[model samples]
Target: MFDIIIRSATQRKVRSGLTVSGIALGIFALVVMGAMSENFNQTFENSMSLTSDKIRVFAESGMFGGGLTDDKVPDVKRVPGVKDAYGILLTTFDEDQMGMSGKQIFALPPEKSRIALDPVKLKAGRFLEPGDTYQILVGTSIAGEYDLQIGSKLEIHDKNFTVIGILEYTGSFFDSTAAIPLETAQDIYNLEHSLSTIFAVPEEGIDSDILAKRIELNVKGTSTLSPRELQEQASQSLLIFSVITISSALLAAIIGGLSVMNTMLMSVTERTREFGILRAMGAETKDILLITLGEAALLGIIGGLLGIGIGSAAVYLINLWLAGKGIILFAITQRLLVVALLFATVIGTISGLYPAYRATKMSPMEALRYG
Candidate 1:
């Protein structure tokens, strides 16, 4: 039966190839979209994982909005349950500063920034030390995008700073930032003694929620969010992107299924005489149906495998391009591969049912006469 199915498909190579291509396209969409969504979710989760027992305190107006002064840091630390608070000055790099726009600048006191910077692994050189006012640490993305290296000098507002360190990829926005001393950042931005945000660590035995509430009450004009809250907000913002990708994959699959069904129907019509002859030679209706389904299944398997190969290659090229910019947008996983193959197979099998049924229903004599 399998041999018959193979010979039949081979007999019409063009039709079979087109059908396989359609199914492959669908599987390609599924795998690519799934990989992208998974990568995004994992990056966000990994970033949030680093925020153990800490709450972020920022201006109610948002991170880019008018920021709080450094005085807020002491006020937050004075709140009950708060163990320590550190201020970060956030600003953006202009074309004059880094030959590009919107690259982030994070200003931190060398000693106090370790809590936030601990997650960042140094790729080359050393992190900023106390009294290293004119030194800067660049993120992996920034380093790659700007072709910067250790000892490289960056000019910010007519002042030059040496790149003392390069950080490993953290899979977060920090990957695109330049870290400098807080005072230097304040001077550059001309915001005397002001901060972009504050990070507060709760004392041992104090719940983050309780600490966040205390800080919010004690620190005016600022919003406090536990790490989990921040994670949830980020997830919500990315949900739409996930939905669109998945929806497009599904649409492609549906279209592919329809193409499979159409091709299977044509195959059934063309092979009517063969099915009739088999039935006349004592083959059962179930045998004819099985042959039809087997053909569709074979097409699906071939197409799915091809799709996996193509999708993986596409993902590799995409990652290669993004690497130069310090971004990764795809993570092909075992689950995605398994699901893609199974989805393609199921669609093929289901699509073959109508044509298979029609093959089974043909009267042997009528099919022979019609052929």
Candidate 2:
């Protein structure tokens, strides 16, 4: 049946090409949009998973690594429910100041933050060590972007720092962050003993919410967040993106289906004489319907393959472009590919139903004479 459909399509090359293009376009759009949504979900989960067992302390008012002080750490640790706490310093260096464009610096004390740094697996070199002033650990994306290796220099605030390690693709915040010693960060930013945030671990039996509340009360001028709160924030951030991607992909699918329906209808009309001849030669109405539907499904499959191939490449290119900045905005997964193909096939099968029915309704003698 596939061979027959392909033969027929080859005979009407222009029509088949146009029909395939429509399905391909729709599948392409669906794949890219779906991959982006997948990226958001994956990154969100990775981030949430990284901090699920801990609580985050921040300044009462500020965003993106607030100016929370390390002084709050002792107070937070003194809270009964808190087991351990450590401060992390963060600062974004720009092209003018650091000779690097919009790079975020993630600094922590290595000895105290071992558990904290555990998630940040190294790709090429070593993690930050104690007394490691002027050494940096960068994300894989950034390392690849600048062709950086061990001993490569990164200039920040007119000071040259060496890259000692490249971090694994964490699929979290650190994927886009560069790490250094806590004290080094303070010096370069001129923020002596200042921290951007404090990460805390609650006692074994202590609830994160209760620990957060206790820390807030014990440490003044501070804000606290449990994993649940971060989950809520992530969900809120992805809501708009999810809606837009779903709506656009669905719209494209509908348009593609319509294109298939129109093209199939025309093909049935043009093939009336051929169908009539087949019927006269002992072909049943079911045979006519089967042939027409099979052709439509074949077009869909070809289009889907074309679309998926192109879409996957597009996703790679997009990720590659942002990888330099230590970011990935799209991810192509095997599940997404299967879904795209199935969606295309469904659209094709449904679109062919009406045209197939029309062909079945044609009388052999009348169709042969009319055409």
Candidate 3:
């Protein structure tokens, strides 16, 4: 039976090749899109890990509203079930300064700052100490890109600060940012006594949602966002990625399936007398059905394999391009490859269903009399 299917496909090389190419194109899209989405999710999760268990307090009642007044940090700490809280000052430094285009900056009190940016191990020098005015910490990415070292001076807001530390490569968003003392940042940004956001941790076993709610109800002119809320937002964002991949995959599949169906339909028509001969030689309906479906599935399998090879090469090239920027944003995993192949095979078999059924329904004598 398999030999017969192989012979049939080989005899109709042009149609078979076209059908396979279509299915392969669909799988290629599927693999490429799937890999990109996975890489995006991974990067996003890594960046979010730091605040995974903490809640963010925003002043002015909206998630991205105006900065919270510096005085709100103590008030938030006093809230019941609140274990600890710290205010963070986040902003973009002058792009022209030090050739850092829109460099992300985070500032917190040297003494109270527990944010290590990925538990950020230090590569050189030491972290900022209390009362260390005009001091800064730089990530490995920035240090390498700018040739910065301990004792290197970075000019921010018309003031030069000595780099006290170079953080280890964290592969997260932090790698592109620099850290500064809280007071220094406030003075430079002219945001005296103002905070971008507050990070709050709940007491052991305290419900984060309840704590967030209580903070919102008690803290006047403030809004609270819990980790759960962040997770929900992440889900929504990831869903967009999924929708994009799935929609493209579906469209590709449909095109590939139609091609397979057309090819198989033509083949069945051309093989009427051929099927009649097989039936007269004691071939069963199921045998004809399997042969037709098998031929289509064979095309699908070949196409899927081709697609995987092409997609893998594309992913490799993409990663190479991103490597220079300290990024690896595409990956083609084993599971994704397996799933792509299975999907291709299923699509091929399904597209041949009608034609296979039609072939089985033919009367041997009538088929023999016809073409």
**Best TM-score among the predictions, by candidate number:** 1
lDDT, candidate 3, 109-202, per-residue tens: 8876445353667889987889888999887766766678899998877899899988877656677678899889999888898888888889
Q: Which model scores highest in lDDT?
A: 1
Provide the global lDDT of candidate 2 against the true structure.
0.83
Model 3, 365: alpha-carbon shift in Å?
A: 2.0
Model 1: residues >4 Å from true position, as ranges?
93-103, 156-159, 282-286
Evaluated at residue 117, the lDDT of candidate 3 is 52
The TM-score of candidate 3 is 0.85
**How many steric clashes does model 1 contain?**
0
Better of 1 and 3 by TM-score: 1
lDDT of 1 by residue, 209-257 (tens): 7788778888899998887688778889779878999789978976888
Poorest lDDT segment (10 consecutive residues) of candidate 1:
93-102
How many collisions per candidate? 0, 0, 0
